[model samples]
Target: MSSVRKIVSTLVFAALTITSFQPALALSRVKDLVEVEGIRENMLVGYGLVTGLNGTGDSLKNAPFTQQTIQTMLERMGVNTRGQTMQTKNTAAVMVTAKLPAFASTGNNIDVSVSAMGDAKSLQGGTLLVTTLFGADGQIYALAQGPVAIGGFSAQGDAGSVTRGVPTAGRIPNGAIVEREIGFNLAAERSLKLSLRNPDLTTAARIASAVNTYVGSPVAVASDPATVRLAIPADYKGGVVGMLTDIEQVKVATDQSAKVVVNEATGVIVMGSDVRISTVAIAQGNLTIKVTETPEVSQPGPLSNGTTQTMPRTKIDIDEGKGKRMIVMKEGVSLQNLVDGLNALGVGPRDIISILQAIKAAGALQAEIQVIG
Candidate 1:
């Protein structure tokens, strides 16, 4: 009873201290936490062919799609390949992808990524022909064309081959030209919505307060933890650009819940600033078993016609840490105290992971435990 009461008293004091000090260190920018609803990028994808490979291209016999695409491309350019057999390893079928940024206008150039879609060894020295990039709506938005800049290469020897990085993927800088515009009239809309990247009621409320205070009006309202509604001001009516510029620059304080993330594969443990632990006792030790084998040759008796024999010898050993002792962790331990306590146990990172898991299972850890990898 005495130990429990002492722990409870310590936790109460620590909670109060933590709450008072948080206001000084939780500042963040509005742009980092919230994003406008309609301001986003779109993914564009297209099928194209990469030519001028030194025999590392797709084999026409294995990938018929490559031959078909080449034939179609040539036919569109007034080339007659109808009755001719197209058997070549200098062309490869590839998928080109790019991102169309919001508010992008026609004639704007963007980079495109090219990846082989067929059995191609390398796309090192290849040129991507003219291809139309389409969005999810099946509308052509951009046209991509140029020589590919492969970041890696592949070489073969008589014995083996060596590859550095990804030889089947390449990039073309400023190779895609926007042909159509996807317009979003934010100025024409009556109200604007801000979406929180990580939804939290405290963060949403703080954002709303900051915007309202800066605009000197109660035009901003927190609809929920993930959404904020802002009414257009009279001065900025039909001119949402200025209002959004100011809103995105406003500074606000954000809040985070106590969490502990553990990566089992790498034996990494991360703890939040407000993580706490109730009074608990922990004792850890490792048991290791080792085995050894030895073979010996036996000789026949001096005068007897006995055959030579062999004898096998085996040895087993076990070692378990006998000096391990339980250590009691007091409640409401600070970050420094927690580190010191864990270090005092003289255990490695893997052992610490097991200890943390055991603590969480015993309901002594006062934070959400997330195990990944």
Candidate 2:
């Protein structure tokens, strides 16, 4: 019995020790906080033609380019339509766009977006022709050809028409086949850089520290707030790829600057965790003046020859909010305290935005105020 009790107590003590050493929930993996440089997507764009439209295609007389493209395509198919008036409403000129993902191999299929470049009412049930997608370097990298899948439709009668969603734009999943590959040798590289999505000096340093601790050496260094440089050690195996795979999993606690973002158009306010404020007094009020007009009719008395007339009367009322009082905030208030203080004043988001701006102007706000939209 004594031995069994001692074992149980030992297990409980071990469990508590493990729980105490567990990482905090606020820590984030290095991969989510930073992006590996040179591993990115490339934009590819092309011009194509959509066929099989149901009388909702581009008008040939209005879009001359559409007629010209059609003529050129038919000439390649051993048909001459240049001298003839070919009025067709089953084709539309469209622009095709796709993104070539990082390390995309040849023959890999990618999705493509098709948008009507001309005045096409709808692209429903249209099939895209063979379009050569070009990269920014003007080199063809992919070929796109598939049936366009649109989310909306258009139907019109003699008087009215109703459309749902965007009928002129559609997508074709796995519509593009990559014909070329962007050459990148991740394993052969001697060094690599990590770019922080949100640049901060403290976050960068913390990331560097985490990487060094994981590798048991100072292999990573924070060069700047936005970039961290990592040098491959000589004894490190599996090359740069292996080193990155191991370091990216290391967790680090990130820090950010105190900021207050307010969107005037949406009346949204976002305050950071570290936001602080100095002692400031704030008072919010509004003044409104209202004018009302009333018309009075004047009539002749006892059937005299006087004409009836209208006399204008105006009433003006002025209201100055005199019930509002000034509220004093102490120095070094946290974000929650600040929100509570603002809410105590019974003001809406718009009014709070104005008050924050006024506080910032008076040099009382310690955090950076960003007004957007």
Candidate 3:
């Protein structure tokens, strides 16, 4: 009996240790928390046409842009159209869009998304012609041209129409080639600036400390909660690439403010670890009402010559659920305790959402509550 008790005690201690070992704060790599300034993707857009759509393309009379673009394309191909009126239903006008990543070089291929810009039935099995994709500065940066790979299809018959996925938008892998590159040199800067996606003073301080410790010198400075400045060290003066690589690999502990997010449309509720609530009591119940109607026909007695008659009867019932039972939550309750208490109440997700809103309104919830549809 003594040996058995000792073994059980040891197992219980080990289990407790394992369960309590979770880090209250999460560790995140520098690369995910911060981004190098001036290093981002640029949006490129253009208008073009998609051809080879089997009889599902836009009507020429309805989508004039399709006819006009075809005419212009044909004219560019050295076709004379002095008095020509052509009609074709195998083409669609589309908007070509691509993201030009930083440091993209000439002759490099990139993917492009093509969306129907006019009233088109489907863009499946279509080929996009050469189109000039221009940046926001109005400078031509790349050219997009390739066969569109549509992920959806549509079919129609005398009965009705059926569509699977979106057939009007498609993607062309490696369809655009970069012609010009953005002028920015990473190694030329004396100091590199890292911008945090979510600004927090404590996280910035931790990052700065981690960098300084790793480099054995004070090369990183937390200029603000959102920005960190790093001066290039003499040994790394050859190139800032190595320093950036090291800085991005450092891991720092992260903490966020307590917040409770609720989505009413899907009835989703998310609570952070630090979420708490003051002592509060909640009582909720539902009332249901139902009405039933019945119609009956009455026949005249035999040989009485009485006319037939119809009678209507209605029944109504009202039911109030089991009397509301109040549940009291103590102050600074743990998430497990709160969840168990709510579960014992047997309320649904939507009911929980409404209860949380009421609690927040009553100033009992000790965290910010965000409600989204």
- By lDDT, the best candidate is 2
Ranking by TM-score: 3, 2, 1
Candidate 1: regions farther than 4 A off = 1-23, 236-238, 289-318
What's each prediction's TM-score?
0.84, 0.86, 0.86
Residue 178, model 1: Cα distance from true site in angstroms:
0.5
Off by over 4 Å in 2: 1-25, 287-322
**Whole-model lDDT, model 2:** 0.93
lDDT tens string, model 1, 188-299?
A: 8778889999998989999999999998999899999999998888676336888888788898978878888889999988888888899998887768789999989999
Ranking by lDDT: 2, 1, 3
Across 156-176, the per-residue lDDT of candidate 2 in tens digits comes to: 899999999999999999999
Lowest lDDT 10-residue stretch of candidate 1: 232-241
lDDT of 3 by residue, 78-161 (tens): 987646776777899999999999999999999999999888889989999999999999999999999999999899999999
lDDT of each: 0.90, 0.93, 0.89
Model 3 / residue 151 / CA error / Å: 1.3
> Which residue ranges in model 3 land beyond 4 Å of their true spot?
1-24, 290-319
Q: RMSD of model 1, in Å? A: 8.0
